[model samples]
Target: MACRQPPLNSKRPRTLLCHDMKGGYLEDRFIQGTNTEDCYIFYHWASIDIFNYFSHHMVTIPPVCWTNAAHKHGVAVLGTFITEWESGKDICESFLSSEDSFRAVADKMVQIAEFYRFDGWLINIENLLCPDAVKNTPIFLRYLTDKMHSSVPGSLVIWYDSVLEDGKLKWQNELNNQNRVFFNACDGMFTNYNWKEEHLQRMVAIAEDRLVDVYVGVDVFARSEVVGGKFETNLSLQMIRKYGFSAALFAPGWVFECLPTNEFHQNQNKFWNLLCDYLPTHSVSMLPFTTSFCQGFGKRLFFRGKEVHAGNWFNLNAQEMQPLFVDQKLAGAGGSWVRTRGCSEDAWNGGCCLLIEGALVSEKPNVSVRLLSLLAQASPRLFISFIYKQDCSDRVRLALEVTTTNSCSCENSQITTPQDHRKGTIPHLLPETDNLVSQFKKQCDTQPVEGWTINCYLLELQESFLENVFVNISRLPDADAKYKEKEEPFAFRVGEIRILDVNSLFAAPVQVQNLTMCNTLWRRGFNDCKKRENQLYLSTTLRWFYPPNTAVNFRIFCKGMEHHQSVTIAESEKMVLIGRAYNRVYRVVDIPIPDPPVGTSGQVEFLVQPITKEGFVGQSSNCSRLVVNYLEKQ
Candidate 1:
């Protein structure tokens, strides 16, 4: 997915994130489901939102995953260009041999920046250079900086505090004359993390006009130098701010990579909060939407904002509103299992859904999601959409069980209300019971072979509903005698579980129409649909009733046959721009259509979700399907 360059922020004390995890990107999974805005609340005041993908390579482009995740949080991401160790010295020698050679390399680097859509690069030259090479290095840096600025506006080229003007690999750890020459050529410099208080003061003095450009480095994992790394991290942050310098935090992945698995989220919070204590509190806006589930699009397992490369996990539930719940104890303990196979396309806006199937035990397993108070106060309507499929010809029943406590007001106790509420026991409160507010059932069809149908249940909440409510999708007891003895469990898959505020006047509805599909191939740099069986693409036209400058997004969901069962192939696109356009716009999306499962007719289903620019997902359009029986002969 190509993206436009992020806007520049002139905020002071900018925080640069140097992401280095296990030799850089090895077994690295960027699953940012948690609200990072809340995690780094201190960063709101200080511009703490630049992510740099750090690796010891000649040309390291930031991965699409990192770019997508960072952009979602309104953060800028940068790739790395480093020349380190013996091989790097050779690379620098060949590139800086002549002025023309240097200029040619700089142009190529500029081309890479335009192609990848990252903001800029962090140039780290950590190897010794010859006198001739060192003299031309500044020229090369100047050329690269000028070309990059011209090609990609608002782009940055940060220099690491390594290598001196005398052609030697030295860590100055301060903004002195030895490194001042190189620093002057780039946008900023990242100082070595092993600097002292005097060094920071000296650097601040040296960078009098551009204090924000000099970023003091802090290594959160290196305990040998920084005693009590977590607390010391706060001290470094304080000292950098006191000296009027930006901060560069290196290797923050230590919170996940080194800490205990269960305590990863807690330790991460504590570590960040220590930094927060030094800085003034700032209120970051809560995310407009949040959801919790154990399953994802690919085979990789992501739970509680952490990704495990290898696992066919089932029944692992993460915590609500917090990012620390990787419960391995319940792995495969199984009352509810996620069925990646035969899963229908997600009916809602997200990439994947909870494909659950199992018999209800004496204590029914339930997953509770915490909703924001904004949602409750808005008195929004909740919609639970899922696909139900079963072997028996019996009706499948499920319900939304809401657990809320009611607060009663006294007749003439306005003065006593505060004390009663604080005691957690209102004298006039009524006893509350769990209410089965909404129920949904799918009746047996005429042909009872295994099949699925989409169902939706809506429940509108009032202000009386408590802050935290648990909506459980549980199986109701069967009354039929004949089917009661059957051991086979009924299966149902949840697609879109959303809470929407329909009361807002600005919340206009969007409609998707005129869906079409065709087979296409990339020939001569353009899509040609003349040839069949090359690739499948779908196009749809959308209409919305919103004013100009309103941002709208369309997400396409596709389901195809895999191993004789329907499984989701394409969930959603990464950050497609449908915003700022007038009333109607047509979008063409690639549909991932695999060969039909054995003994099954080739078919695919497409669904579209229209969402607001603020991340509020709307209802799913009715499925627009295509049958590919023509490919069977081929």
Candidate 2:
């Protein structure tokens, strides 16, 4: 195929971007924010259960064959190369022993650039521990730039500075920034997430005035892939740049949880800096504990004291994270069902409140409310988990509906025209949602109120993820418009929230039994290394399929209770016991959490099948039984 020629009138400079891992860019738009009309996601970090040790040290980045398919689109295609762990030792170690590895990688990058003909390079200097850590990195960067510049002179190099975060006046950010200046290197940089506005100003000021040919890059964890003609992340980039700062996408890792396999039209695509792509995004912080929005999935509803401020799905920056050596095991629960934040001084628990809502509120008059917009790109089941206190004066209503282009000329689909079933039950197959529309509408008439107890609610809808109401009236002036198009805040008291993709449950093994007991004991005697040793029972409530009368073999995967993703089971032995001997089946394995799995995740999945050679009796019915069990949750 012939490579397309660049337009002569185009003034945007060409650039080279190298991140640590591979972020296959897809051109799909799922979310829309301010200037994100031309924005797309790159990659965000992987799930604790999904991303672990083996993927950390090195990676092989694949070319973006999908991005090249778009012949008419004017957007530029960029690739990345990243560094694992912000540890300088890791970076040096990778390049130290094998010079050939670096050369081979560099050669591959050149080949990719020549082949794909991307817009420019998103050069990242990821995860710098301090100035001392990255001092030698500039040497490598300068040499790499020299080689790269020799060929791709028009290529831009964007660096991610880690030193200037909210706290810790570390030497790394300055060292890297100054080194880029000393070498007359770097086209621009993706500014840190937590740095102050003033810090951002100074960085941009220095890049434009001090550095010969540099700019400031703002990294956005946009809520969606497309806003206008591009991904939604661009809106944030545009907003930040107007303040004299440029920007780029902080890529979300592998899967697009918001999108289902059917909606495979790649709408959420863009490039982001990776850890191995450069350094981890956290390690690349330029400020200290600046406490900004951390990337998340599903949808987010923000609360300040007793009011809801803003709510939207969070777009993750996968490329900016380091792979965990020991990852958490996946709990077979669907999208986040709960949320809460705690005071920095809260004594109840540390980050425990991170999963609850309402705990983060202050004792002030109620103000605004925020509601989340569900994704249409994929099937979504919103589960909200938060702790509500008595006499809180705020009524939390959870509802979901279908969303579609609703202009008068637009055709009606399941999302746009939902069937009106019972007033509150789940809307069967339509693109809408069934919400836990708070029955406790009025502020409780009693302390330790009836509705204030801790509870988990399952809300499924064929509709949408948004509604227009403050408290519970469906008429808040400030609610987001995905449902009604109003733009006002709602009142809410919150802690943290957990949003799970209902389907994600399929890949996770079944939780055998309650670990609350094991968890408590482990915390005490387990040497702080709370790895447990038990083949805890899987609650067996929900599952895709269950085997019957089988002697087939499989093992149980175990882990700590508090730590869902970290497996404590020895890979060698994993067979779990279930049922009695006669009707007792021993060969049930791969007990996946049901699609839209319900109930709080609690054990082990066994590979069960019949000892019969007669093609396994009742295979089909067995599957049906499994589905029935899953749907009949408490």
lDDT by residue (530-565, candidate 2, tens digit) is: 353332222332222234322221122222222233
TM-scores for every candidate against the unseen true structure: 0.55, 0.30
In model 1, the Cα lDDT at residue 60 comes to 86
- Model 1 spans > 4 angstroms off: 1-11, 27-47, 223-228, 278-602, 606-624, 630-634
The local lDDT score (0 to 100) that residue 518 gets in candidate 1 is 42
Highest lDDT model number: 1
lDDT of 1 by residue, 1-634 (tens): 1121112345445678788876664432332222121121111211245789888767888765456445433456788989988888998888888999999988888898788777788889889988888898888888888888898877788889999999899987788989888888878898887888889767766887899888778888875565235535787888878877878889877777777745654565466656653432111122233333212232333221223223221111111111111111123324532121213133122223444444433233333221112112324454333333333334434433332234421111111111232222111111122121121111111121234444344445455432222223334555666644543354544433333333322344445555554443212222354455454343333333333333333444444523224333334422222111212333333433445555544555544554443334444432223333423343
- After the best TM-score superposition of candidate 1, give how far the Cα of residue 457 lies from its true spot, in angstroms: 22
lDDT of 2 at 110: 66
